[model samples]
Target: MKTYIYKIAALIVIATALHSCEDAIDLEPISDIGADGFYANADQVNLGIIGAYNSLQEKQFDEWVVTELRSDNTQLSFDNSQNANVPYRQLDQFVSNPLNEFTSSYWRASYKTIGLSNHVIEAIDVVEDATLAAQYEGEARFLRGHSLFNLVRLYGGVFIVTETVDASQARNLERKSIEEAYTVIIEDLEFAYNNLPDSYGSDQAGRATKWAAGLELGKALLTLGTSDSKVRAEIVLRDVVSSSGGRLLDNYEDVFDTNNEMNDEIFFAVRYQSGLVGLGAPFANLFSPRASENSVVFGGGDEFNVPTEGMESLYAANDPRAGVNFSTSWVDNVGNTNFERFISKYNSDFGNVDDAPNDWVISRYADAVLLLAETINENSGPTTEAVDLLNLVKNRANQPDAVATDVDTFFEFKLALEEERRKEFAFENHRWFDLVRNNRAVTVMNNHFATDFQYNDPDAPFFNTAPIQQFQTLLPIPQYEIDLNPSVAQNVGY
Candidate 1:
């Protein structure tokens, strides 16, 4: 069993947390503040941290809709065949729907985690051991900062809730500016990097570490897109590359192999269990061909996050990632003769429905290496050091790479960096944010709508509808949020 699999119910959470979306954040003060005091020891504080991880698992499952499906990486397998998949199709085509359930659930789960982490941060002072107290606080802060970083990137502005407020106050919370959100994210991650441990024991495999926080902090700085921020990011990311004890696996396929769990390459991942414990991952079934029956996995696949044909061409001629990430067709397990393609990263044999033990790897050394290359390029144009960094991942995949003379200008190097990241992180939920980070979402996606979307879903709205506008890059504030919190207005051009 994966460590950190504590019963989330051990944490003091509201009963309605997982299902409620009416409020911006749901919180309730603990009823028993008895003689022992609130969260008086390390174990109690750890429960809240586990609860935050639980919420992260829920939040991250929704990321493919907003990030991968919307990007050129993936799309709906059979857009017209699945009626229940309309919301996914809408996101795939960039439709104007503010009430997408996936979007709302993602928003609610993120704040729900922030609320739980806030409780941990506020209650950690009572722990007697200073080191444990700081580590616990750092973990909580890291979770909170991670949530805020994703929120600000996906939505232009979002409500900021540092302290646990009464559930009644949810209606009154106001969305803060993107600048303010980044400020809190940077501050929290900095604290996490300073206080978190460099590594965890064998029993605790997936707990947040100093290396994870530093990578995240560097990413936030790079996303902020200032010259000085890029320089600062370069310093932090370089340290993660050299001193964080992270190393890439020899084979690209081994990175996601179920048998090689928690290998040296993975820096952080949301661990899952395979028994009927209600804590296992759902991607194996969710990403498989819906009609594959038992051929792809136990039960039937949901056929979500299907890889696009366009994604196949993004890789180089000899690139091996396409074979590892996805496949072209499969025999009909139930004899339906289906050829739908699903992401193969999580193809482990599953028992019950949506109950596979594949850990959702959130950060790895290869990702950090590529981010370092990006920072190096942004700092100095087409530098040899930057090209060398890019070649590290390329060489692993057995693909041809430039000699630094080929990419003479900054723009060429930038394109190379983006393409490398595109293939390396395919179906890992990093595409849309990457485009926005490079300020190429509008141009690249518009071209996709005109060309690729036409090839994939030519009958969809693009035949008569318009491509995404500049303001539409930020997802619309879910209408359900505005319904509950009137003070929180919808994002512009929704």
Candidate 2:
């Protein structure tokens, strides 16, 4: 994230051989000058790669509704009765069905990125420079694998479309088992780790590096939770910590400073530029308090992914990241003070309505470091090394560092780790996945319903009690996807 190379490239980047559609996963246009003809030259192939990265910009706006909003870490700030807020309400309450529009849009945007990556993968073969072609494919695979990882986690078994296909073929294709899906994901990341460079030149600042791919691969291996996979994950992630040339920025706020963007702490981020050629982030405008409207963002804020009171309290007294994460109060147009707080991470770069230059971070060094500690704990148990890794993040937040005994046992260490992550990455969209991957989603969310839903939560009083069973942990397959292809069965209990 150090260099900002793309001021012009953020201009609507079309993959030379791309056939993308943002409506559905398998609905890419069947006819186009496919990858081979249009991206026959090396320069065109690079453009196709850049286009895949550009596709990620579209998903940043909606990714959190399914991720953070679904978790207890964030909630809809108010109990409003509007139609557009209904999907968010359903998700926050754990009653969202497959037809939830927010998840549907998220699904479409994810697949658009995946589809674009696939086109770039196929087109890379036309480039004569073999090394460059492999690097390009590695970047494409990292993006595709990253998207597939999200799809598999959100919806159970999703269609594994690695290539362009006609509607007929896509309709007939069956969803892969979670195991089968991960097989493809791990393979792609493995290829990425081998081929991607440890670092890129200034010309390609934010492109996926070997360290980024390794962290993601280590995460996939850890998610598998097999003994062999955990061992591999530890090895992979250890290498990232020791050799990646990335470090946690000392000042917590400096990490997200709008003007001081370049730093080694970022491993990979969905890059955004704000000149309004269609590639800026919308978190500032969309997630700010609606009351702040023209006073804060030029247009009104939607109050999406607003902080929960429980989430706000996670920060310790004088914790460094608290101010950077969110703001507690706002004065609306009529000067009414409200508790409907907004996230401040993306607030610094607000350019206009729906346009902010803040990039959405997907992978960062601290995430990897914490994950490394998790891998070590799972692979072996709580060790000195693991405790050190856990304390690194805490120390950065000005919280007291943990001693060996505090996290001496596996269960204690796990809980401590989760709490630290919750505080460190509250609105960055890590809470739900952390719970699910560690097998606590069902229990934690049910507790949220019983306690928070019944008491102080703002939106809780609006809806009936929504307790989730085991099956509810996995979202119902998007109703639109099932509607498009009758063979695509919905997840059980839909």
Candidate 3:
């Protein structure tokens, strides 16, 4: 049997003690009590900020969870009608309602990180060093904005807490409108872009940079403008101009290699150090299958995410990215041979049956370039510049250049961009959001899956059976949260 280092009860006791002692301490009176105590100096601020990064390392945000939600993987189940197991590739059918623990964990983890970031931002003023204080605040803002952006996209409207709210008040908080939520996200990212340094020194590699903030802000603005009014469109375009420095890496395939984490294209990423205090499982082990002989035992489990045929078909034959992103076969170090459709993008070995030290990229220049191209095309019909940008991505993928003989209409350009995004970012936890934002999820699902897709069904034990609506685009407020907080209103269908 696999050994667990810490028992669940022991972990719970340690966590409770740490949080409980926060209110009772302050006898020495270093900084303000509670959250403020953690940010008294530069080192302290760095540690606190890193803690926020650690939140992303939770199992729920790991590669398994991300890949499972991608268009590539199918949720497998026993088929009662067929008397055998069948691959249920329909995401909407399984993703709805309060039963999805993956979605629930993501919702809770994002807010927890946000709460930690809120603490850091509030405490920055108490830091005595002016320059250091500004830097710390900028980093905190970036973390806060990034967390909220992910939360908003997944849940639509979420509780927007600027300051440290009482746990009690946190429960009673109301959901902000999508517009209002994006406004705050933009504001925080803008602050980060202005105050953060252009690059971190060698000592601080993997930390947030000004360009990182810009890329994130640009993406946030681009997403916000998609479904909103013309005013939001104008605002996002302006932000895009200021944020995109027009610097994209020449090679896209190298961006995923562990050696390239420090490449200019990588804006911000969560740095993982194996054997460090906060270090945990690496992503490669999570996506590599159990039956594969080439696999390593990190987190003591089989690779959980296997790419589907539909996802594999998106790539053209002989595309370089296909081999680099995943491996259908491989040979081990000792001359042993193996074969499987295993994810190799996050491959890293730490020489033990534990998580390896591999960083997860949050924002990258390649994504920025593609997103800018998409945004420009959406606002105006496909232009030569837009085509050039899109082609740059294709060229890196080792595909023939994309040529648009004629300028397509806005909607047509959008469809083309969606197809490009699906191919370029297949397993990066973006396809679902892309479909939802474009208002094409239902249409796409209906077209692709035919009679297999159903969402929001109360009659079925696994999901809510209610009819899908435009408003159902957002996920329901998690049931446990609503149960705990009486004031919390459920999303339309719950």
Clashes of 1: 0
Give the top-scoring candidate (lDDT).
Answer: 1
Instruction: Sort the predicted structures by TM-score, highest score first.
Output: 2, 1, 3
Model 3 residue runs over 4 Å out of place are: 1-33, 59-92, 226-250, 276-278, 293-303, 329-340, 451-472
TM-score of 2: 0.93
The C-alpha local distance difference test score for the whole of candidate 3 amounts to 0.61
lDDT of 1: 0.80
- Candidate 1 deviates by what RMSD? 2.7
Q: Which stretches of candidate 1 lie over 4 Å from their true place?
A: 1-23, 28-38, 82-84, 334-338, 453-465
TM-score of each: 0.93, 0.93, 0.80
Error (Å) of candidate 2 at residue 408 is 1.2
Q: lDDT tens string, model 2, 1-494?
A: 34554545523346333455533474462236555666667786677677667777767677888888888877775546545577788888778888888778777878777777787787776778889889999999998899999889988798887886665676577888999999999999999999999897776788899999999999999998889999999999999999999999998888777665546898888877676756677888878887677765667687777776676677876997888888887777787887656787887645577777788888888989999999999978999999999999998888888966779999999989998888877788889999999999988887776766433446545555566888887888887667767878889988
lDDT of 2: 0.79
Question: Least lDDT summed over 10 consecutive residues: which range in candidate 3?
Answer: 20-29
lDDT of 1 at 60: 76
Show where candidate 2 strays beyond 4 Å.
1-24, 27-31, 82-84, 331-339, 453-461
**Relative to the unseen true structure, what is the Cα RMSD of model 2?**
2.5
- Candidate 1, which ten residues in sequence have the lowest lDDT sum? 11-20
- Candidate 3 per-residue lDDT, tens place, 336-374, comes to 776546666667766554456566666666676677777
- In the predicted model 2, the residue pairs found to clash are 2-262
